[model samples]
Target chain A: MRIFGLRKNTMQEELKHNGLYSRSRQALLLLACFLLITFLASFCLGRYGVPLDELIKIILSKLFPIEQSWTSQMETVVFNIRLPRILMACLVGCCLSVAGVSYQGVFQNPMAAPDILGASSGAAFGAALAILNSASNRMITVSAFIFSLITVCIVYFIGQRAPGHRVVNLILAGIMVSSLFSAGTSYIKLVADPTNQLPEITYWLMGSLSGTRMSSIGFVIIPMLLGLIPLFLLRWQLNVLTLGDDEARTMGINTNLLRFVIIICSTLITAASVSVSGMIGWVGLVIPHLCRKIVGGNYKYLMPATIIVGATFLLIVDNFSRNLMATEIPIGILTAFIGAPFFIYLITRKEKML
Target chain B: MSLTTQNLSFSYGIHPVLSGLNFSVEPGQLVSVLGPNGVGKSTLFRCMLGLLSGYSGRIMLNGLEISSFSVRELAHRIAYIPQSHGQSFNYTVFDMVLMGTTHQFTPFASPKKRQIDAAQMALEQLGIESLSKKSFCCISGGEQQLVLIARALAQQASIFLMDEPTANLDYGNQSRVLDCVKQLSQNGYTILLSTHNPQHALFYSDTILALHGGTIAAFGVPDDVMDESLIRLLYGMEVEFMDAGKTRLIVPAQGRGDLCFVGSHR
Candidate 1:
């Protein structure tokens, strides 16, 4: 009987090993190479007709001191517009996806997204209120930052104090607070000065990379990168946290402290993303799950894959929004247009719910 | 070598789960906790491992208060295998077991070579070394239980607190797990485990504790707590204790005479 059991276990083990090897490592390598290629392609393909050779030459010139008569238009297209937009997309995408991944692990729910817990709504309300009160642009960002922090604090209190402290209750509280704040935002929009601030508010809510300037890039990049620093440093603790709160505590981790730090970090990441990009949707939610399906769930693997995939995904979404039609669709609309269908495909194609 | 409790009590909201529960164990002794389902067996283990808070209790391990030790220090002293875990989403078996060595690692440090070897040894001890690469959720329930127990063993703690380690196993696996528990005890690890199976308690434990209504009902030798009246009180049913040569068994009083006669004839 023991011999039979051993033989059966070995056969089962071999089959599982084959499946894991075939699916995980190759998918990871392919996704990594695909992200790199997409980033380079996004850099090269644009309205200014920079051929791949000139693009590579321009890139090499920038890196090394190669002499070439690069036109002012080419320089402006490459360095000023395309580079900043791509960099912003990469930063915001990476930030949002990392936040999404952390939140999913912390909450242990696959449906969790970056904005699901009122972070984006809270930031939007802050930005809108800033517009209402004639606050400076920088101060508008600060308002968004502070209010997003407040939203999470309120949600945490409500969820933690509920009867069972259930994950569903937390999610419900997030939706409740989110809708409430969004309604408040609508009210602000209703009463704003239509001639001056209305277009600003409308465009801000629509989310765009059209206004991608180097200064604006620095504004969001600095804080978002700072917010991501802690996550990178404590990445392993994040993995341990996925084992659930009780198990994490039993493993000699102070689960509450780690969770509090994570909430602050991811909130900062999310708030910074919204403060700059004005609420790009679905990249955070979809990118991490896509990466997880491809690379398995170890955060050591999941984190880097998420960064690269998020960058590539947003770049692609931006490309579609830019050239797919005569009029530029807002990046948010394109994200939703592409994201919902792709997410549906993922859900349908998935054999098991993670 | 000794763990002693002084007037330990725990409550949730207003209702107490364990009140004034006192017990002690020395090195190399296997202790069994027998109680009905909701009699605070799991809670008691949680408290002993310092997982639950808001409890007024004094649990001392080797002359030190349990609460005084850091979580890592406490984990080094007492390892636990919980009865149930919420399903993991495709975490590799090796990663699941490697988590046990988190206490040994320097917070963010990855598992060292020695720790990996230790985890491998623990899996081998449970006869599941081949499961190291399998997704944890894809394995059978019994195999999962073995992996968890193997993880607890990898902790290398001096004391083991197991909450129903054999609760979900089939008879063959149950016997194997119990034999492992016995072997651990013989190697001078003090073990206190809660179980629903009286036979496991009888066959493996050197000390038996029976709890009822948040208090200790019977405590001492297997011969003392394994009596019909105490077992009936603990389980709230009539049970007949019978001895056949060196083996002991408990059966319901009224219906199972045929099986008993067959065993007697055998």
Candidate 2:
């Protein structure tokens, strides 16, 4: 009976529906604390290696009048180099993961990820196109962001015009459009010089947070917020929206409009994150699933938990990517290497993944 | 307020699903829709719930047209109970029921104490409060149906539109769900339930609206409109009305000549 889902939750009724939920509240608090700790530790990492005490004092100097004892090199490493990259890593992870959860909710498909609507693929095409033309990194990011938005818009329009279940149509249209952009990227890569342009295009496609500057964050922050803020605000409607179209409509949701908003917001996050970080895999797909294990599957907890865990997951992965060897490993490769085995381990365990 | 549909007709291109249907369901009446497969019972419920907007007719909730009301206003007035099915994620029973009260709050806001209390009260009313913390997908089909009913109850709507509420349920669960629905009508809640069984309609419903080929076959109290001929017209089968004390049962007619033993089997 226990194995077959007949297990009765025996926690006292007075525990505020206590079994999974109260435990998740505690888990969320613990994860937040852990994220804070990791954030501090990341500031001290890298070849420059600022000591923990110096790191704390330097952080405190911003608030109170603490004497700056640390050298200018440490300051540069913390503020100029590590700070931007670390924040970029965390933000990109957070955005993509949240966008993944939103897409899954919107499409009601568990396999849905940040690129379900072709945002990342479209960004890739833009990045590849930029690299072929020998454009600057800033131009590549701009091109990627613009094309990503355009790709999702095209998918949405085609999805609406196509006949069938809207969710199925949208998903199929996403596949069609994503393949189209992916082919474009392939063509661009083929035409580029094998010496310089090819390597650059290939590396960008592999996804990295290397050379992340404050300006990179500056370019993407607005669209990311435009996406993340609305998703965070519309968290509750998520539960109803996942019930499919007619069910959601009868539940008093304007299913078309809600789907549109979720798609747009999630697309913004995906495009923004991919423009800077390239097509980072698994952070968006796996983080939400992991968060669902930690917290229950309710969107209220799952969404926020994904945000924290995503930031933490990518930050740690970036740490390993940068520090694991002399040459920086591509973060995308590290994610699949680390994420897939861990996910296999998770699924092999007793509890259900969904 | 009563729900009335006037010449409500809908089609998929030239393929008509429901056409020129007119019926009225009064307050606190348990109206069971009985039909054969593809008789547009589902389509009728869809039109009534204001889901199929392409339909050309007026569906009035009280005095106002259903189309004139906002989605929130319609939800406040009528709760829809879809058949229990699997979802991509496993939300808790409490979370499932809490979804019904979402119309009372904004999308940006989480469920507050008022919404929680309503959801709890609904579960309590259905006597399934103990299942609150359990995974919805883990529960039995019966319990899932009950949870959906509890969800509809939490919506605080006077009218309920259920689409094949017992489609995949076992006989025991089907009766249990129908009994609960019967109790709701007795407690002064209006309910529109669609089912395949004429016996369930006769025993549990106050009125029966039978549909055939996208049109009304019969619409009235079961006592006045239900019989063997009507069943024959609807299902194209010979059935007899067998008396079972107070409630009559629809049984297949005995002694079919084709089914007679003509072969060598002793």
Candidate 3:
């Protein structure tokens, strides 16, 4: 008589777990190629179109000495215009998705988005306040980032002291604090000049990468890397965190410390992403979910997969936002348009809840 | 090879849960702790695992205090097998088992070849390697319990802290899990398992420790320490002892003649 259970081994299982790795690895490679293609193609698909050959020469000129076959107009658009925007789209996309996935794991809640801890709302209020005060663009970004961190700090402090399950309390605190900052933003919008500051605040609130310059990348890359690298390294702990707090602690994980670090890093990434690009939605929430569908839930695969898919997805969406109409569509609108429907499809198509 | 807690007392906001609790578990013994819900069984386990660090008194492993050891050092000695996890991710059984080796990894390092082999060996030891490729959420309750135990085995720890390992299983699965647990002690692993069922302790435990009212109710060899009064004290229920060939059973005393079979059971 069988004491435990039946054993019928699959051939893939016989491959000593490399099969899972290989499939995810192959998919990641394909997605990386796709992301690269999207990156290059975004450089070529603007209103003042740079042809593929011209785009290639423009990129190669940076590496090796080449004759200036491209016109000054094309050079200005590529170097000062499209390049920064493309890089910003990719960086913001990657950061948001990574932060989103990290928050989901840390909180053990699939519904935990990048801004679930009030970072975006804080950044929004900061930007609106800055625009009202007539602060320069750089100071606006800095203010947004600072207030974003400060908002999450307040939420975390309150959440820690709230009398219930920590995760639930944190989420509840996030909702309340988010509304508080959003109300602050509404008040700032109420008093600002409608023609200039009000429109600027409104447009920024809707999210755009339109004015991203080379300097913008320099501002964000440091904090983004600071946040992203630790998250990438701590992907293993992210998996343990998903098992809940007690089990993770028993597995020798310093759960509270690990969680604090994860929260701080995720907040850094989210705050930086929002500070520059306004509040771009859906890429963070949807890209990770899509990656989970492609690769299984193991963070080892999911983290890298989300990075590639998120960057590619945002690049493609940003391209459409620019080229779709004479007036550039705010990326926030496009992402919600694309992201909400796709998220619904994912939820409905699968028997499992993501 | 020994775990001893001396005058270990814990409280939540001044309402004490476990007070002056003292017990020592021997090496390679399957010691079952019988206790009712909210009688501080879980709180006691938390204190022992070092999750609740605000507790008073000392818990020592072998000879040293548990608090002195690093998290990794403690994990290398004592493995915790939770009843089940609240996993929303579709991690495979192999991935679930692989997490057992997290304690061995240095900071920023993922599991390597040595850890992978350990996880594989753990599944093989439990004879559940076939389930390695299956999603953890898709497995049966019994199979999930075995997988959790396999994870503990992968930790390579001598002591296992299991709180109600069979509390959620079917009758057949419960025995199967107990049989697997019993075999672990035979193989020289110290196990401290908590249960609501008294018979499980009588049949499988080397020693039974019953907790009630913030203290040790009784602690000794299961057969010698257990009686009708003790059962009543622990569970607040009436039970009669039925003598078997070698062991005995605790059956609920009195009849249900006042009530019908179909009344508001659930």
Candidate 4:
């Protein structure tokens, strides 16, 4: 009843008026519970399997000392290995989903994602070049970050005409830029040392959190979190922006300025995520949409819910990647496998993704 | 505040759309910009609102240079309603109308209670408060236009600039919107509206600016701009005016080269 108090009343009112089953409250609660359960399942089951009871004990031991034989090794698995991976999954999930929501609003297109604007391809190319040059790990991430920023700047410069009427044109420009960078990546792969660089690049493209460490997570968390903060603060403005340029302008918004700020912020968050974790697609395209189906389109509710659902979805995927077979699978592969069918379902709905 | 554009010249790239266009409307005055299509009416309005730059002249709000005002300052002074805008997604009528309050509310804040009350009042002013919960895209063209007008009203600006306010409305709805415009004028709001229908201009507007090929061919009262030879030269059709008591009617002559009044005269 507490969970359903304000939200259920709003949903009932929305349903009475809109008549389209405004189950935003019900859907959000269900998603929250499912995400929590999934997160717990992710922690409990992995290649180095800790049973649910053991997992609970491990969690509790951090709070209160529990004398056990499995303490040291359990600490290593939970704190050293799994914690960083879970946190990385959470960071990437929040980055991608928030970026997706922002991109959709900026372009006024339901299907927009970070990759559409060449952020993923540019980061992949940067990392590939770094690997080819035998660069340091930090340099590789730095290069990816810079290149993603460059890609966004180029796309915005080419697509903008006059002011904030760049919705359709901007997406078209992003598609063109994305293809160009993808072609560059292919060329780099072709000429690279096949035994070492080619394999590394290929694996990076497939994406995995296997290599994620606390240090690497530290490198990404600060920048992505900083960039995400502004986005959360401006969520309502983003919603107002989706009403089209004229309406937004009429509302006394300097729409062009708002567009520029949002693009830079979301791009930074996206580029930082890709730099650390490699090319993880579909989470950006799919998670925010799934959240929208549950939380309605208001960013106040949608942003937090999308972050939670996305983190849970990816953490579960990361767990499956490690434990599904004898060899660790790439997170991207699992996402595509699951996302394709769900995306197909979304496409068949009355309002297909623009 | 009164709105005026003095010797306002605006061009898109090589071709000029409005040149040396001088016009004025006092506070509480309702003026119409009536001309054939592509006569630079919207361009003129855009220049006045500072939506378009690179113009070679001046637009003044209450005798203050429009160029001196920031976008927010201009928005607070004047509200513009576009001819017809596309809704790519579903937003409720209340949400749509509430957008006009963005000037007063920060991006971090939702509209306050007072703002919501103002929006509801604006909707009621247009007699469509019941439709506030409906999807904006689901409404009829006239209803959408009214909602748009309501949004402009919610801005609480003293001046209104509307492009083709009656284009999508039927006769009855057109009259209703015009009546709303009339009421706004009576309530001490200044209005500048663009329309293709000269009859609407004659009926609702005190001043008419006849635009021809990017320049003001004629300007003044409706009767003055609606002259016989000037209308023929501007629209390439013979036209005449007939006085019926207090009302003057604009009637286009039936055949070519026959600028004669065929209607009953008072």
Q: Using DockQ as the measure, which candidate wins? A: 2
**Which model, 1 or 3, shows the larger TM-score?**
3
Q: Report the candidate with higher TM-score, 3 versus 4.
A: 3
Give the per-residue lDDT digits (tens) of candidate 2, residues B58-117: 899897899898888888889999899988887999999989998887768888767777
Kindly report which residue stretches of model 4 are placed more than 4 angstroms away from their true locations once superposed. A1-34, A51-57, A60-70, A136-139, A159-169, A346-354, B240-251, B255-266
* Residue lDDT tens for model 4, A171-222: 8788899899999999999999999889988988888888678999888888
| Per-residue lDDT of model 3, residues A1-354, tens digit only | 342222223222346767646878899999999998888888899789899998899889999999988898998898899989999999999999999999999889776799999999999999999999999999999999999999999999999998879988899999999999999999999999998999999999999998899998999999999999999999988998899888888888988889999999999999999999998987888988889878888898899998888888888989999999999999999999998998788768757645
DockQ of 1: 0.26
Q: How well is each residue in B82-151 modelled by candidate 3, as lDDT tens digits?
A: 9975477788899899999999987588988777778887998999989988889988999999999999
Where model 1 places Cα greater than 4 Å from the true spot, the runs are: A1-30, A133-140, A160-169, A193-199, A346-350, B84-88, B255-266
Q: Which ten residues in a row have the lowest lDDT in candidate 4 chain A?
A: A13-22
lDDT of 2 by residue, A52-171 (tens): 999998878888998889998888788889999999989998998999999989878767888988998999999999888889989999999999999999999999999878889889
Sort by DockQ, top down from the best: 2, 3, 4, 1
Alpha-carbon runs more than 4 Å astray in model 3? A1-15, A66-69, A347-350, B254-266
- For model 1 the local lDDT of residue A191 reads 96
Candidate lDDT values, in order:
0.81, 0.88, 0.90, 0.80
> Can you give the lDDT of residue A318 in candidate 4?
86
lDDT of 4 at A209: 84
Clashing pairs in 3: none
